[model samples]
Target: MAQSGGEKQGKLDFDESRIDSGIDSYKSISREQDASSDRSQEKEKACVTDERLDSAYVSSSLNVDSLGDIIEQCSISECESATDCEYTEEEVNFLTTVTEDGDTILHLAVIHEEECFARQLIDLFSPELMDIQNNLYQTPLHLATYLNLPSVVKGLVKKRVSLELQDQDGNTPLHVACEQGFWDCANEMIHNASPSKLSCVLEAQNWRGLTCLHVATLRKHHRLMRLLLKNGVDLNLQEGTSGKTALHVAVELHDAPAVNMLLNKGANVDAAMFNGCTALHLAVGRQDATIANLLCQAGADKMIRNMEDETALDLADGNDDILALFPFDDIQIMGRTVMSFS
Candidate 1:
């Protein structure tokens, strides 16, 4: 049946509108499919990257174990030379690669106490590799000293590994030895290092502002103290925090024997702190009669005034034992209360 022109025109317009709507829907679906494909590709790429990293990590770890096997098979005693031990390119590369924790092969070897392997690695590797620090900035020498492995220390020293490299706490290998009281390791480092290097190591203050001598005294390591003294450490070297010398530290700790040792070693009895308080001031302040007596006998100035302008006698105002050590005249004049030892 023929329809009227108006009806036909209306039908055509309706048909065109439906066609336009269909095209818009098709375009939306196409855009969605493209976005989905891009997301899938991205996921696949991420997976590939993760797999590579994992594989590399695993490979490097396996190489570390394999290196240990090589060391075992060709023991130091049997191996003609450290360089004679054959290594594959991969194995050699593993020496330079660090673990996630930033420990190189040499660090792991020392931590595991593979002493023989450590010595071999020390000999085989260059100074750069031998001295590579971990995340803690702890060199192999630092670990050897901390672990008290004197032989490993000797190996590192002979190879000229830097003795001055500090850990996270800014402690050099020598500082660690003195703090830990590892006599043999300390001795090895002290004697092997050149005179200039030894002096530098001794002078370096850690983050806590403590030198090797200060640490030894604070820790009450008498033998180590003696070793440091014998090595020519300044008897009156003051610590950074309060300018307290080893003598001041001893008296404050109530260490009679250490006080006597330092005095005999030529420690200045009048060496004052940043506060101008002598060891005697510390002794009297702490009410330590024994140390005060030791300092007095060692010729400590009883009248040395501190930054607070309080003499040892003033700090000892109420203590009769301490007051008795001072001359009657000085106590009467300077002390708040007069007490006569005679």
Candidate 2:
């Protein structure tokens, strides 16, 4: 393999041609252009880590009998003594290593939650290490967020890990934090991120048609919901293929806090789903009187009909208390009066 030495086999991975500054692509994976889809098979018998590269060197240049000397020096405890643990001149050439899945040591360390181990490696390595992608195309930040490891999340952020890398599902770590309701992790990202990164997180739609705000609301995570609102997410952004806003989701879940928060934030209560059922209709149909009353107080259109031309009152089965709250005669007059004023 040394006979075929070129950029990948014998050069620094971060040569001038490789590292594009201010960009957020994975691993600075300009390294990707060098590989075929079969790179995994190609890398199989090659020097995997510097550990293996040293072994290959010892076996080829000296003798296999000296292999134990290299192993004993590579230990964490042994590495504490600088003179005892220093790599040979050849070993330093392959210092950075990758797992079979294309994850750097940082990716593996964060995934396995080796806090002290990962921190030591991170402090020694460049922040660029955090940006490396695994076979799944998830950076350490994405993995850390998925695992809800806030310490790792903060450590990477402090190191200036690129916040923009997405997994195959188009989820940034901030998106994962919000979707998983990892509020502290999400908060760290929100407060610490660059304005552009924060905006990206705020507007990113996941595979499920949920932005971070929609996920927070759907999960009824009140603190996260308030945080998103304070940061100014579009309150009425319709979610999913069904065109349901966060308010619609809250109504169906009978989540009064989310419903009230959304209403107070000026979400359009009459915004209909694909079936033309307004928030009021959902609240009544689901028989959540507290949520229905909250919506009504927020000025939900009581007489707003579905595509079937059936009003929420009409959908109110046997629940006279719900029917009585509608004020059918009064809402008609009030609607007509509002239309006249318009």
Candidate 3:
């Protein structure tokens, strides 16, 4: 049966103007036209009538036998046509069916911020159904995390959905939370996770070879970093491309505070990249004296060489301040040690 032309509570119109409203709603608020203006009143009434007629036509033509038939025709119908339909056995079946885009009703519920409906769907759907990925390869939990929907995130987490499920970017739901700096969502997911499972997720690297900690550092989400660290995320986990640890990334970004935080968290001060260049090598290469000093204070080995056989001292040739961070006497000592070894 077609949903009525009159609006249902919390149901949004799916007209062209509002087709992408679920995502656009977060971007900005649309200005309302002055109601007292005669032209505005006439335009509003016309829009309402057009929408109702369009919805009625689509609903009349909607054939429910095939999976896409109902949704394809109804996509232009009122939002309630699909979401707030009568709870018949057929409607229940449609709720369970995966749409052509790979979305379940659960995914739509999260997208629309239909909290009460989403919670009811969560209870009705099994963990497996909740984990269904759409064409974008995002699960409802992934969408919830991305959209910063904490209550929905909590509901999904409580349902024990697979947090390890990675989206197209290889970002697990937790990775998405950290990437987007959604602290509440990350907190809910982590707190609800078992210790062993949490460990796996904390270490799960994305396609960029970045773990949740790496993502937090890249995004400059200090609070999220602390949260992951507190939950036992490895500070020294490296990215796949360059094998740069969070400290390496921080140093490269010249984020003194992040470097300091990672240091205090016991990140290996001299962790080297895949190229055999330590974080100190990066600091010296960039000639960042403050970071060089910080690394030296943290006991970064000065004599470490990269694949290019360039020591942090070798890279610090022209910058006196950075060179001074490694004492002249220390350079002589390092030189003699190399001489002796050679």
Winning model by TM-score: 1
Q: Which candidate should be chosen as best, given lDDT against the real structure?
A: 1
lDDT (0-100) at residue 157 of candidate 3? Answer: 83
TM-score of 2: 0.66
Q: Candidate 1, residues 1-342: lDDT per residue as tens digits?
A: 224653321110111111111111111111122232334443233222111211211112223223334443433344456665554565566456675556676776676466877887787888888788876787888877777789999988988888888888889999988888899999998898889888988888999889999999999999999999999899888888899999999987889999999999999999999989999999999999899999998898988899999999999868988878876743565557566555
From the highest TM-score down, the ranking of the candidates is 1, 3, 2
Q: Estimate the lDDT of model 3.
A: 0.73
Query: What TM-score would each prediction reach against the true structure?
Result: 0.75, 0.66, 0.73
Q: What is the lDDT of candidate 1?
A: 0.73
Root mean square deviation (Cα) for candidate 2: 12.9
Mind giving the per-residue lDDT tens digits that candidate 2 earns over 1-342? 232332223221222222112322222112222233233444334312222211111111111111212222233342442223344344443335554556565664554455655665555556676687766678888877887778878878877788877777777887777777898888777777777767766777777777777788877788888988887688888777788888998888888888888888888888998889899998888888888889888888887778999898887897876876765433346446433211
* Residue 40 in candidate 2, Cα distance off native in Å: 35
Better of 1 and 2 by lDDT: 1
* Candidate 3 lDDT score at position 25: 18
State model 2's lDDT.
0.65
**Which pairs clash in the backbone of model 1?**
none
Candidates in descending lDDT order: 1, 3, 2
